[model samples]
Target: MNAMTTLTYFFPRRVLRAVVVLLSCVCLAASAAESEAAEQPNIIFILADDLGYGDLSCYGQKNFKTPNLDRMAKEGMRFTQHYAGCTVCAPSRACLLSGQHTGHVHQRANGPIEFRPDPQDISIGRLLKNAGYHTAMIGKSGLACNSQNGNHPAEKGFDHFFGYISHGAAHRYYPQVLWRDGEKVQYPDNHGKEGKHYSTDMFVADAKEYIKEHKDGPFFLHLSLQAPHADLNVPAKWRDPFVGKFKEKPHTKDSHYRNETHPKATFAGMVTNLDDAVGQILDELKEQGIDENTIVMFASDNGPMSEGGWDRNFFNSGGPLKGGKRDMYEGGVRVPMIAWQPGKIAAGETSDHVSAFWDFVPTACEAAGIKPPADTDGLSYLPTLYGKGEQPEHDYLYWEFHERGGKQAVRQGDWKAVRLDFQTDPSRPLELYNLADDLAETKNVAAEHPEIVARMREIMRKAHVDTELFKIPAN
Candidate 1:
């Protein structure tokens, strides 16, 4: 007390006041930081494999209803003109995680052989991990690389990862093995056709558990579900309801996919099962009281596929668009996309904002209050989600496919152009369509619109950066 009294007498009143003000400011700054962290919403991105634009009830599925997904759209923002990164799985996911388009992204195709990307390429998982979010990737990851090469989801910045690492391995619903982090977790019970553990069910259960464990988190979860894709597999409970719902069509031709007595019904049931999985995750979030602090987004990696005994025409899976998975048409790339966040994103909003998978990284970064890498070919759609601020628009969108003899497509405004077999015939004439008038792409108006076609041709050429891995031959 004697020393404190002597020091206080030596110190001037203005100096003592300045010290108090500085200490108060420090406390206020710390409190603001804590508040900001609490406000950073947890992000959950649910990617469906081969689920089409019209597969969901809200999106015009007549055979089966996706009440959960429909409700998600009702409570959030539904994107009418959203597109996937590519027409296939591997490249589409590559574009998504890398924040690059198919033109610029690594792993441009689901090749005969698996391809691995450069380890230096940044991923959305790494971006969020750096932003202090607990990251996990569950279900099928078709990213073309594994932990051995330092490209598995865990090595790519996800703190945890579970499910199938290979795209081909993910085709089977009842798997004998699944990946957990860097190790393979064997499922003895899921042996052959006598397995009770469906991969979809397991993924949903694990996702719920992950949410529960990270209830207080600003976590980032990529729950990639393998459903309504192929093999015509679904639990009896889901399949039985739609057993006789449609006229029976037995699919026995495809040796690659399992023989299904009721292919249509099974396909419908698989979609409904996927819908139920989404509902379960939403319920878990609500139960954990984190619904308001979470942003849940659902989208398919690509459009519908006629593989695995699943019929695209029967489901009208591509909606009013033409073509399917392999084609560069609207049906192949255009997909269903929805975003939900209570108290933040206003309900009952449908955004016709033309967006794509590449935009996700920037959007997520903005949501987390982190600056995205400057070189990304994506724009944040956060402003559109919040229903405020001036939303930026893209000049055009481009996609190139290596399979199906190589293809390229470009969409600028309402004008869409498709160039087939571009690798072998670089001088192939671009088939142009006015999407606003011909959404089905039945009419090729390229001859009538030579100027627009010429512009699209140039854009396509400029957009494609020649790569040894996925090459587009010169004219």
Candidate 2:
């Protein structure tokens, strides 16, 4: 202080003023840098319903055409060993949105857990909203969290909401009514065959409008798209592209090329329509010049059900992984995941660091320079997204889905244990696989590793509280 005062006296008033101004500018720059580092990335989390790990062209499914998704994959990082927390929609959505595992939310399979938590339980959308982000939920939503007024998107921190609460409305490409921020935004009262609307188109339109409106500010869009899910009804404008295909159910087809069959071709059409929607959103982002600042994450709710999906012997739904949809197998849990950020994330990068559904909540928070709420099961993958981290996100992954009805599985490091509910009588046999060696889960090593099974059982025991039903069912 003495030296500074002496220098100020010697330099006179103008010098002192200049020095003060320069120092202030430096401080301001430092503050701005800190803010810039903490600045949010406009996030667009696109989730496809019942979309398989191998469904997209980027994921190596030769049968289906997912050009938009493939393009997005090429622009960013792709994870080969990503998984869904639950095998079905309701629980999976609950886990992903809450940043906790299904156990924490007491949501398992389609309806194992009931009752939505109070709106303050800290969901991703809510966190973003708390951080002053313009949030929206643009598609399928089914959660047992604050949905008494049925958890409409805005109440959950989504400023804009479009789409349906039921998984059925999403299952259809067109519906009679869609919810817009807790209100029933319906379509034509009666469809007389003139000016018929498609659901995919409607979702895309809403997504585009949202983007067009919010590109200037930091925004988060949960574009939960329902495609390749079920019902097998696609409009002619979308379906006309694929007239020949295969069956959704168990049917036999002997065609070297998948397009020749009825079901496969129909499935291809569904995928194409979904891809078109993806293109539309991306285009909107580009048109608005927010493509570079935006970080978009794409994934499916779960693996294909092996029913009403790209169901064919040739179409390896999980593609080299064993199990489909409900089982605690690779095919069922592991699905394709892509993260794209222009000029930030490396293009065409691939990682196998064991990511999961819960990771997104924290990851998005990190991107926004916000901290995750306490009691979250997820860890941020922001460092990994920028290709900086080496350690895997989680050392162990657990699954308790009723999809296999009564299946319990746990994965620690490279080892995994899977026990079917009714394999025998009341006691089902546990099957263990070293996923490092057997991605297909073709061999069971549980008999050889009793100690590991005991240790895993202990892990499950400690994690029991998360699985307990936190709230009773409605009615």
Candidate 2 clashes: the total is 16
* Candidate 1 displacement at residue 344 in angstroms: 1.7
lDDT by residue for model 1 (239-308), tens: 8988877888688877677778888888888998999999999999999999999999999999899976
Q: Please give the CA lDDT of all the candidate structures.
A: 0.87, 0.73
List where candidate 1 sits over 4 angstroms from the true fold.
1-29, 112-119, 145-151, 192-194
- Once model 1 is optimally superposed onto the true structure by TM-score, how far is the C-alpha of residue 405 displaced, in angstroms? 1.1
Candidate of highest lDDT: 1
- Badly placed stretches (over 4 Å) of model 2 are 1-38, 112-120, 144-151, 189-195, 245-261, 308-314, 389-392, 422-427, 466-475
Stretch of 10 with least lDDT, candidate 1? 142-151
